[model samples]
Target: MEMLTVLLVVIPLISAPITAIIANRYVAWLITLVTCLALAGLSGVVLHHVISGEVIHYELGGWKPPWGIEYVIDSLNALVAVIVAFIALITVIYGSKSAEKEIHDSQIHLFYAAFQLVILGLLGMALTGDIFNLFVFLEISSLSSYALIAMGQKRQALVASFNYLMAGTLGATFFLLGIGFLYAASGTLNMADIALRFDQFSSMTLVITALLFILIGLALKAAVFPLHSWLPEAYTQAPTMVTVFLASTSTKVAIYVLIRTLYQVFPNTYWEEMLLPGFLLLSGCLGMLYGSYKAIRQVSIKRLLAYSSVAQLGYMVVGVGLNNEAGLIAAIVHMFNHAITKAALFMAAGLVLMRLHTTNLEKLRGAGKTMPWTTGAFALAGLSLIGVPGTAGFISKWYLVQAALEKGNYVVAGTILIASIMAIMYVWKIIETLYFEGPDKLTVHKVGSGKEIVPDLPVATFCCYVMVATCFYFGLYTDIPLEAANTAVEVLFSTGGGQ
Candidate 1:
């Protein structure tokens, strides 16, 4: 079971090179799919083992922690690992036909290779016990993401990638510098070791500076408001599948790191004394309102979703900022729920792009009637985004409201409600476009047939179904995810009892 920890990172890293070497595109995709599936399965097994009271630890090259590299799978990391793997598996399946359409034929294999590397990097970040190792994996994922976004055919794709590169590099550098400060102060690179050693620091200034740098770096990476300028263009111009994967996983990983830092690395007394909780709560509230306001103004469907992501991230931050059991649970649950819902929505959008050759809201007129299933899936995901009753989004919001109320913060509860309404506005915009308007005036070109007809690829449709089913399944029966989230939260706040 301990060895399984290494496999999560090793499998995808190995498969990436193999994918690039493969001659056939189909074979390359097959390799990527198989590897992702294996990762998901392994993650599940590890999660189960952890739940059964096992802590899996693997030392790299047989070197013990505090001296050498180590992988630690606690309840929290295991849950996140499983979520990352599951999302990657779904994205890879969805990428098949979509990639073929959006990317050059000769570059398809390289795309898969980069895709695997991104997954590998995410998993590595989740499982590694060292802060420096986290930065290393962060760069791997960021570089691959830049390449993936640049693969888009849009004229602005290169520009968007370049912008993202600059922002992402700065964020990574800030994070690296913070880690360097901690290592200088604590004389250890291991996260667990640092946690134990952090108490030795008497200088509040050093701690504050380190925390600020890390928080800002992660906020930039997570695209938190005021630092999220790179996201809309990146999402709008990136290949649809790349957008979906990044939307669902990348920022969520950043949030995971934030949680680890706040609840695990820093002392509870330090957090409370600095008023970090209140600060985060205020930032989150502002981000939620700001992101939603921006989202409502977008004409491009992808850009709309991109802005909505900023708002959604704000909700997660609210949960974390609440700094209580209910708040933490809400954050974790929202993280998972949003991932599935957003993935489904993006996949549906990708399908529409396949048929319409455009993601402009006006151009997507009558997609609801022409592509009923895809459009229906989008509507379902949109409802989830709105926190409609019986959807996964509702559960997260429900908990968030409860958390805010528990703290006697009626303002926070009201903010959550207002954010939900804002989400409805943006979501309804797309829904109205799809259902109320007339079909696109342009003739549709058949995929691979050179005929003037709708191009409804089976692979793309299947991908949408997979995502939609996941959204609905997780929404109605919230036991598994809810339970996992609760357990993970328990681990986060157990030691720090709001002191």
Candidate 2:
């Protein structure tokens, strides 16, 4: 209990270099897997403690809060840490097989090591109660992600990696500048302490500027529209396994930072104002419509999914814009739902890419009959992405609608409905390419009922199935995310409680 928070950062931070020392790729992968398993277990335990109405605060170097670095676990951050670790655990398990196919044998060990660092950075960012510590971890994750993305088979990956580095560096800079402003104003780095002191400088120009800087910085990392130019290319050209991990973790952590900073460090009146709401709503609407539109026109299946992610991110932003309890819960739940669904979808993409050596929609025609399990996974995840009834996505949309109605924001509600319809269009195309399309493009034939052929990926199929099953499980048994999100909202907004 005393060491849980520090261990969350330490275990994986130490494991990365140790895993890199291994000569064998498979051995390195196993080491990384074990590391993720431990972290996942720890995250679950911490979440259990937090949900049981206990907060754990661990001070670094034997110093207490407001003077030394702190790691705090309340319902909000505990839930985020769990989601990050859970997705990372799944990615490490799922990526081991996919990495073997996508990356060079010589570089595979480094890939696994960098993968651990990325997970370490994300988990650390979520667990840290210090603003400056968050920035440090953010850099770690960003640096590791650049290396992983550069390991892609495509030459274009180098350019994508460079673009990401540039954007991420700028984002980190903005975040640091914001932190400097806050420190100047309050002379504290601890988040709880800063929150307590916010009132002292609420009317100062530096404080508002600090908030603006932080918001812009996080938006860049979160791939919010206008600043999201790096995401599509990065996702498209990165190794399939790398894409799965980044798609699941990176932006979600950025969103967590944004949520925490606003709710914990700023006054409610400032955060809930027209400027913030209007900015979020307008950007969300644009990204939702524009991203889905671009997705529909994409020839590459991976690129299609990439654009779809842009739209999915918009839904999360919209949930934040609503600024109500239901809206916040909608955003938090969607973060989990989207992370798992995107991870599964990307896993399905990896499976198809491994078999066909391509992710072109035309090249993958009729693959559903051959790799039925893999395609089934893709189809199911796609349904969740579309917010279909009884799927996790639907629950998020339902709450978003309820919030919109409660706020009397019919336009935003209608926009959400329209976005869901757009999701249907893109996802239907993926399904059609998988199933109804002919197998005229197949060059290699396998023994499957004597007619159609596909690659047998039982392990990948099983992993993907497990991901899809969670979509169904969470949809029907909504208590987990709902309860956690509601608790988070209550704690965050309760008078004097955010501190």
Candidate 3:
């Protein structure tokens, strides 16, 4: 079991270089597919073990306690690990064909290598018990993500990557500085140890400084409004596959870190005095409104979805800000729900782009008739995004509204409803384009062979079906994610067990 813990990180990291070395694209994709499947299986096993009231703790180099590096797998981290790995698995399957369409043949192997590395970093961040190790893994993922985003079509991709690099670096530096302060105050880097030692520093000003720095850094990384300038470009210009992975998992991992630092490492008494929940609530409300307003005016479909991400993240933060058990569970459930829904939507966008060679809404007239299954899948996912009942998105929104009502905050509940309406408007724009707009009548031209040649899209109706099935499956059942989220919240807020 202990060995299994390390394998989560080891398998992906080791497979990356081997995938890069393989010259044949088919072989490289095969390698990536196998590795992702293995990871998904391993993550499921770990989740099962953790949910059975077993926490897996593995110390590096046989060293234990506050000294050596450790990997901690409790119900909270294990559930998130499963989410991240599952997203990776689905994205890789979607990517196998999509990569051939968008990326050049020569770059295929490199793409897979970087893709696996990003997943490894996310898994590492989730499992590590040490704050410094978390920062290290965060950087590894951020840097690789920059490269992946830079590999897009527009010259603006370079500019987008550069901007993200600057922002991500500053965010990372702030996190490192915060870790430095914590180390200075407590002389320990392990999270559990820091929680244990935090009370000893009754008058520690550095802890407060550390708290602010870490919060700001994580907020920036998570693209929580006002610091979200870099996200639109990065998501719009990056390769579709990269956008899918980042949308589904990367920022969610950052939010997980925020949850860990605020609720797990710091004492609850500290937040009570600081009114942290109020501050979070304020920012979250602003982000939700601001992002939805911006999304309504976007001409590019991908850009619109990117803005929606900012709003969706706001929903998750609102749950955290409520500072109640129901609120926390709502936040966790939405995190998982948004990940799958966004990944499915983005995958569908990639398929459309492959056929049309563009993501501009104006150019996508009557795509529904031509690509019925793929467009239908997008519409379903879009409906989920709007929180229509009987979908995964509805489940999260239902809980969020319930939490707001529980707190007797009618204004917050109203805000959630209004924001969701805004989401419906933007989602409907794409749907309208696909179904109502008539296809342009253009002269057909044939090149190369006598066979009528159309753009070879990597994603087929089959890939779209897989994602749509997943959306409905989790949407209807609701037991697994809700249970896991409830357990995680209980573990996080239990007295004498950190915050």
Candidate 4:
């Protein structure tokens, strides 16, 4: 069990270079599939142990904590790890066709290589106990993502990737400064060690500065509004598959880090003493309304969904700020629910992009009649996004409303309802364009035979169906994420930092 920690990171780390060296695109994709499968299985095992109330702590090279690096597996990180790997697995399976279509044949292997590194980085960030190591992993993911986005079919992808690189570098700088300030204050870099000694230097002004820097850095990475300028273009310009994978996993991981740092590394009292909770609540509320409003106005389906991600992220941030059990549960469970919901939505969009070669609202008119399976999947996932009953999105919003009301924050509660209404508007825009309008006959593709045919993506469509089912299944079940989130919150708030 203990070896599982190193294995999770190592498998992908070793495979990445090999996949890059392989010239065959098919071979590279196969390696990626196998790697993701292994990661998903290993992550599930880790989550299982964590859910059973067992924490796995592994010292690097037999070095003890406070003096050497460590990997700590608790419910919070374990669940996040599972989400990352499972999404990667499904994405690799769904992406083979999409990748072949959008990327130059020469660059496909390199793309898969970068994809593996992104996984490696995300998992490392979740498992490592040292703050500096977390930054290292962050760079791994960010650097790889930049390259991956740049490989998109459109020329604008290069510009979008460059912009993302600039934002990511700035965020990493802030994060590193925070780590330096923290080390100066606590005389340690290990998270558990820092937590244990945090109080001794909590009164120092440097500690407060560190916390602020860290918060800003993570908020930028998570694309909280006002710092999300890079996301819309990136998600819109990147290849269909790249957008789907990153949309599902990247910001969610950043939010998980924010949750862990606030609740575990520092203290819940920081929420009160520094008035951090109010700041978060305000930012989150603003982001929610602003993101949703922007989403409703986008003509490109991909960009519309990009703005929608900002809104969904706002919900998670709001829940975090509420600073109660219900709020924490809302935040954590929403991470899982939103990952699947958004992935399904993006998957459906990707299918349309693959078939029609465009995601423009005007071009995709009447896609529901021509591409029924994909359109149906999009509609179902959109319901979840709108918080309709019996869908995963509803579960997240319900908890959020409960948390807001519990705190007597009627305005925040009202903001949530309003955002859902805004979501419905944008979602209906796509639905109406796809179903109610007439097909753009001139844009439809035809073969030499002059016969119209819709291409089939059996595996990809199946993957989308699987994701859509999970959205409904988890919404109804509720226990899986709730149990993990409840235990994670308990551990985070416990004495001794659950170490």
Candidate 5:
């Protein structure tokens, strides 16, 4: 089990350099696919152990906690790691055909290399027990992500990457400073150790200062609104597959870090005293409104979804801010729900880009006639995004509404419904364009055989269909995600904070 835990990070970390050195795009793609497959399998095993109530803790270099690097896999992180791995696998499969259209052939190998590194970084962040190590993994992911976004087809990609770099660096710096203050107060870098010693050496000043720094830093990374200036353009311009992977996993992983720090590292007394829950609730409500409003304004499909991500993130954060079992469960379950829902939406958009060569709402008119599979997948996923009953998105929102009302926070409950209505507006824009309007003749294209393609992009559309199915399957099944979330919530409350 320990070997499996270490291998999860090692496989991708090792494969990345090999892919880079090969300099063959196909080989790199193959290596990336294999690596993701292995990771997905390993993550499943880890999750199984976690579900069995075994916490897998491995001390790196034969040194004990507080003295050496450590990897910890509990119910919370195991679920997150599984999400990242499987999503990466799906993206890689879809990218096999989609990336060729968007990325230059010469640079594709390097893109795969960076993609592997991203997997390594996210998994490391999920599994690492040391705060400093989490930062290291965070940088590994951030730096590679910048490169990936910069590889977009448009020149604006460079500007977007630069903006993200600036924001990401500032976030990392804040996170590091928080770690320093935490080390000074607790004299240990291991998360569990910090929690154990928290009350012993923690001063009010150091605790508040550390919490603020960490929270702000991670909020930036998570693209929690007000600090999310880098997100829109970045998501809009990145290569389709890269955007898919990132939209599904990156910000969610950052939020996972915040969850770990609050629930596993800091004592219950610390957060309550800091009034963290109220602060999260207020900020989350604002983000929900702001992001949904902006999403309704977007004409570009990718950009519209990007803003929707901001609003969806607000829903998850609101769940956390409620600071109860239902809230935490909602947050965890939504992390999975939103990841797949957004991945499907983006995958569908990629199909549109492949066929029509644009995601412009006006240009995509009547795409449903030419590409019914893609349009249908998009509609299903969009329904989930709108939190319609009998979809994965509805389940998360249901729990969120229950949690908020349980806390006597009627405003939060109302805000959630309002956000759902706003989601319907933006999602309807794409649907109307795809189905209700006439196609622009200028956007049509033909293959070398002079046959115009219909029901375009089978492979990528299949991937999109897979995602769409999960959105509905999980909605109805409910047992897997609910069980994992319930276990995670139980563990978190057991460790510290109580309702």
Candidate 6:
């Protein structure tokens, strides 16, 4: 089991340099696909173990706890790791074909190497028990992500990557400084050990200062509202596969860090003053409104989805601010739902980009008629984005509403309703452009064979359908995500992580 945990991070890191040295796109794709699948399988085994009420802990160099690097697998992190790995599996499979359109041929293998590095970083961040070790993985993910974004064929992608690099560096610095403060206060860096020491400094000024620093830093990484200036352009200009994987996993891993820092390293009473939750609730609501409004104005399909990501992230954070078991469960559920949902949407966007060579809303007019499979996949993903019944998105919103109502926060409940309505409007725009509008809205052209030659696109279309299928399956079945989320929530609120 411990070996499985180690392999989760190792396989991707090991594959990266090998892919780089080979510089063969097909070979890199195969290596990425196989590694992602293996990771998914390993994550499944870890989830099984954690679900059975046992934690998996691995120590490095025969040292223990605060003395050495450690990886801890509990219900919470194991589930998150599973989400990241599984999404990587789906994205890599789809990217194998989609990359042929968006990425430069010379950079293809390099892109795959960076992609693997990203998976490695995310899994490491999720599994590490040491605060400093998490920071190391955070840097790994952030740096590789910059390279991946820079690989975008568009000139603007370099600017976007630079912006991301600047913002990421600021966030990492804040986090590292906070860790220093925490080490000074607790004399240890292990998460569990730090939690055990919170009581000793409950009244200390430095402890609260560290908490604020860490929270702000992670909120930046998660792209929470005002700190999210770097997100839209970054998501819009990056290559399709880069945007897909980052949207589905990177911010999510950052959120995991925030949750772990709060629930594992801080005492319950630390946040009972209503300051953190109240501010989070405010920022979350603003983010939802802001992201939705921007999304509605986007002409580019990818940019629209990028803003929608901001709003969806707001929903998850809103659950956190609710600060209860149901709230935690809603947050976890939404994280998983949004992962698959957004990935599917991006995959669909990639398919359209592959076929039409663009994602402009106007240019996509009548696309549904010619690309039924891709358009249908987009509609399904759109429905999930809107939180319609029988979709994964609905389940998370339902739990969030219930959690809000439980807290006697009717304003939040109302805000959620408004957000859903706003989401519907954006989704309606996509559908209307794809089907209801006329094809003459944009010029049509043919390249090469004049026979409509985009064979690789069909592979991504199939992958998008697979994503849409899971969105419904998880929505209707409801057992897997619910049980895992419930267990995760129980662990955070109960004595599972320790009082």
Task: Give candidate 6 regions above 4 Å deviation.
Answer: 440-442, 445-456, 496-498
- Tens-digit lDDT track for model 1 on 1-499? 8888899999998899989988678998899889999999999999887863356789999999989989988767788888889988888888788898888888999998999999988999899988899989999999999999998877799999999999998998888888888777878888888887676873647767887888889989999877889998998899988999999999998998888888878865687778988888888998899989998998888889998999999999999888788998899889889999889888888888877677788666776777778788899888888998888898999999999999999999999999999999999999998888875444343333222477667877887778777777777899767877777667666666311
Q: Give the per-residue lDDT of model 2 (tens digit) for 95-135.
A: 76678877899999999899989988998899888899889
Per-residue accuracy of model 3 over 199-316 as CA lDDT, tens digit each: 8973689988998899889998999877888899899888878898899999898888887777789866687578988888888888899999999999888899999999999998
How many clashes in each structure? 0, 0, 0, 0, 0, 0
| lDDT preference between candidates 2 and 5, better one | 5
Model 1 reaches what TM-score against the true structure?
0.96
The residue pairs that clash in candidate 1, if any, are none
TM-scores of all predicted structures = 0.96, 0.96, 0.95, 0.97, 0.97, 0.97
Please give the range of 10 consecutive residues that has the lowest summed lDDT in model 3: 442-451
* Candidate 1 C-alpha error for residue 284, in Å: 1.1
How does model 6 score by TM-score?
Answer: 0.97
After superposition on all CA atoms, how large is the RMSD of candidate 1? 2.2
What tens-digit string does per-residue lDDT give for candidate 5 at 119-208?
999999999999999999999999999999999889999999999999999999999999998888878899888887777876658867
Off by over 4 Å in 2: 444-455, 496-499
Over 4 Å off in model 3, which ranges? 440-459, 496-499
Q: What lDDT does candidate 6 reach at residue 345?
A: 95
The C-alpha RMSD of each candidate to the native structure, in angstroms, is 2.2, 2.3, 2.3, 1.7, 1.9, 1.8
Model 4 local distance difference test score: 0.90
In terms of lDDT, the poorest run of 10 residues in model 5 is 442-451
Candidate 1 colliding pairs, count: 0
**Residue pairs in steric clash, candidate 5?**
none
Q: Any idea what lDDT model 3 has?
A: 0.85
Predicted candidate 6, C-alpha RMSD:
1.8
Which pairs clash (backbone N, Cα, C closer than 3 Å) in model 3? none
